[model samples]
Target: MVSQTSHVYRYRVDAEDTIVAVDEWWLAFAKENNSLDLDEASVVGKSLWSFIADHATQKLYKEIHRFVRVTGNPITVPFRCDSPTLRRYMQLTITRHDKQHLDYESVLLRAVPSRRLALLDPIQQRSAAFLTMCSFCKRSLIEPSGWLEIENIAIKLRLYREQTVPEIRYTVCPDCEDHFGSNRQKLESSSEQPPR
Candidate 1:
């Protein structure tokens, strides 16, 4: 078990959603994760959308941002930011900074050591086959078995016997879409004024 450090990384963006500033914690986390390209110097001034790989996840974020802006309320959502050997659970809170700006704070909630799958290893060799992964839950789509966590998928598919792991392609799983989608709709309806 990885002890909870409660590490928080924060960044701010303008109305156009371009990253304006990132805190030192953000930089430190990126370095610790071996994500050099995510360093402050490279990430600052870039569109947030540039970092998101898939459209479904991007759309979910867009809706969350819009909800915060319109309702002037902060929303916290759970997500996974996993490393090859660790499953990192995190919570992201989006708060309105002003009418046209927002602040995003991500806190590490929990982390657990798990058997590593080459599929999650950035440096691992990849096969031609592609695996569709849920961006929010870190689950992979296994046909006939539906969406499954990486550990189960690895065993079910017997990836250990393969020379190379399948490449990961990210998307939103139906469960996540339904959960967030319903909440978004509720927020939208509540924020609407009835009959002026």
Candidate 2:
């Protein structure tokens, strides 16, 4: 028997076991269970396998063998492509048995988003604001606090003129704030003075 270990987990297969064929069977099994989305199917299947691999009983193994025997058909799961060129179109197929002994036809596949994504239906547009750096200080748009400050600054700038007192006071380090305040005072004084 061939056995493999991943971290704390151990997996064993019979000497004649076909890993590739088993993968195909699982893929087909997922489709039978109405899990057409490959990513979701994979996630669920992997979780299930991890559980089974760790604590699989003889009964559970026999049940799985029965499932494969009854289905007798190739299964396919759809997967969305992360690639820009084929971003939304792809699928993966799995069969019950080895390819060489092909009892069933090749599994058919088509891309479909996961059920979770379908439920949420998030906007597909990318946010330019998230991609760009902060406009005022060239700081990267990283960290939750930085993002919050950026949002606050944008809102404040839009609602008030340059001289208007800020409604929402921003907290900066005392040293930095003092230096900035001094620079502002110098600029104002320079503007007020008459040309020499």
Candidate 3:
């Protein structure tokens, strides 16, 4: 039986490198946070790389597995994944095994979202002209007052409402900074809460 550990993903693989089982908590995390659509039972015959969408990450997984399989040595590495929607820092721990019941490699991954990364994805892509916008409200508090219109920013970027691209960036517009700047306690509390 697999034990439950928050933020950790535990799974076993057969000698053939097929995923045989997944832990309960890992399934919950996959459903709630993973962008990949995977079923607890259905994931079993598939290659672990099949569920990973990022090209760079996929390559990383391949290299790591190849090394372990060839050398029969255990390895542990920490890496980060950043996309338009989510950013995570994860530790990949791989161990080689030859147990009677499960004779193969097993991976125990523990990941945490980067405190520096936003929890939510951007509504749309930024225009060619980059703009500093509010994270909570998704608006530009640029000079001359009020939030900038999506259309105008689009024009500057030479993009259309139909073509805005989502990307990752860090900012806290003056409006928010000013409003909550003095109220550190309120700002901290509110920031911890997901945006409405």
Candidate 4:
């Protein structure tokens, strides 16, 4: 049986961003999260882009990858990978292994019990309505205010009263985009050579 106590998950990708390898902990985490499709046989040899659901997040990741390869420096960033009942805070470090490969290491910073949110449950039934959720932070987009946490979204959107929750559509929020955008610009300017 895979250990749930393993807090570190790592994976390696080729220069083209094809998944080449994954640590056992990664498979264990996937299984724990009920993501059976992310098993080794299904994930390995697949393009990383295929796993990212939104274009904006993909674009940001591409920028980060380019920056790392060009500068030969690892980039570490904090992100949330929450489950229905747990709020998992994680840190990811992307290190260039060589000219042809890069390693991504994710360390679980912490996890706290959270109120069960149907919207976050993978097997939950969905209504025709859709909610735009930030891919990085997992916050739902509440118009006018933009992005808000699940708790606030629940009250503001009155999600608890619904018979079925809206389907979540992942996208990068403006805040996340701006944050990565500025970092990308800084990295590009600092790099002595442009990305190939």
Candidate 5:
């Protein structure tokens, strides 16, 4: 079980996506959630986007962030991403605001549930079955959050607690599959280009 982290990832980053300020409490949170071996020094001044390790998560964030930057609006969503040190879940709240006094336009990111907590789902089925999971990220299909960690499948599906891990059938997740199709098209188009 991961220790509940102290800091809640409430930080402000510039429009350029560079973190300009951070909370000291988050330092303690980083200590607890230390997955990617990051510290205060590593976080501040770094591109907020650099922290994401999951391709699917990165892709999703890119789209969401693009819209926020363009629209200057706020958004809140439950996003699962592998943190610096572990695979964890977080509730992300992003807001667009400008500090008139400082002449700064940036985004505020507030993260909740600083640790990876087990998800309990009420299930009527006791029998285990093959589950579809993401081929790349390994996040299984789970309720509420859609795709989550494979550990969650057993809990959500109510599989045998004493039994070994259930079998997982690999398939590209929807988001990644979409990106995969787009990437393949780009690759094909580039391949058709005359070698120049």
Candidate 6:
């Protein structure tokens, strides 16, 4: 039998690596129920999921999502689906925000590195993926690598909405074009320098 302290230690290590925050209520519940049995790890594992489903507050659920995103690791547990088994288990639940309330009906349970739902159309995705720019002209150019012109392209590109392109015209203000041209020259010169 796994001692309660041992179980908690193991759980803390595992959860720390993946989950961002641990729920105090859930931790207390586990400690009280003596669900820390290694021999009956399977039962305890399933019970944990049930406990979360029944008792998890909205804040706790949101914390779990934040944890997964920051850590990039999946939650695990100790149960098998088909026959009945014991090892260790992982469980996760995600809720989407509705206009006024959280929609829990679409909860999902799986390993980590979960996929974010697609919020942009195909054109938007493609444009976002490939669009670059000419600093002088402010033209959006589809390039093989990624967006150019910006010092930190990936970070800056994230600021723009995929569906909305910045207004760049032939009649752009002369001063703005001059500023862009200077930036372009700097970037070009930097690229020409050999790696340090």
Off by over 4 Å in 3: 1-7, 34-36, 53-56, 81-87, 99-196
Predicted candidate 6 versus true structure: per-residue lDDT over 1-196, tens digit per residue: 2211222322221221222233343444344433444233433333233333222222233344343333333322121111001112232233323222221111112222212212112222342233333322233333454334332342445523444433322222244344445434443454344422
The list of candidate 1 runs beyond 4 A from truth reads 1-4, 160-163, 190-196
Q: Is candidate 3 or candidate 6 better by TM-score?
A: 3
lDDT of 4: 0.82
Candidate 5, residue 8: the lDDT equals 53
Residue-pair clashes per candidate: 0, 1, 3, 0, 4, 9
After TM-score superposition, what is the CA distance of residue 124 in candidate 3 from its true location, in Å? 8.0
TM-score of every model versus the real structure: 0.89, 0.21, 0.45, 0.89, 0.47, 0.18
Model 2 alpha-carbon drift over 4 Å, by segment:
1-68, 84-88, 98-196
Evaluation by TM-score, superior candidate among 1 and 6 = 1
Q: Can you give the lDDT of residue 10 in candidate 1?
A: 92
Cα displacement (angstroms), candidate 2, residue 87, comes to 0.5
Ranking by lDDT: 1, 4, 5, 3, 6, 2
Residue 181 error, candidate 3, Å: 44
Q: Which candidate is the best by lDDT?
A: 1
Error of 2 at 68 (Å): 4.1
lDDT of 5 by residue, 51-113 (tens): 654565566555555545544555455434443224545555666556310111222233333
Ranking by TM-score: 4, 1, 5, 3, 2, 6
Which residue pairs of candidate 4 clash?
none
- The alpha-carbon lDDT assigned to residue 113 of candidate 1 equals 81
Better of 1 and 6 by lDDT: 1
**What tens digits encode model 1's per-residue C-alpha lDDT throughout 28-125?**
87777668778888998999999998998898888888778777778888889888778889989999998778999999888888877667766678
* 1-196 per-residue lDDT for model 2 (tens digits): 0011011111223212322223444444444434456433344324233432322222323333333333434333232222111113333333344323222222223323321221111223322232322222222233454443333433433411222222221223333234345434443444344432
Please write out the lDDT profile of model 4 over residues 97-151, one tens digit for every residue: 9999999999887777777766777777799899998887778888798789877
Per-model C-alpha lDDT, please? 0.83, 0.30, 0.47, 0.82, 0.51, 0.30
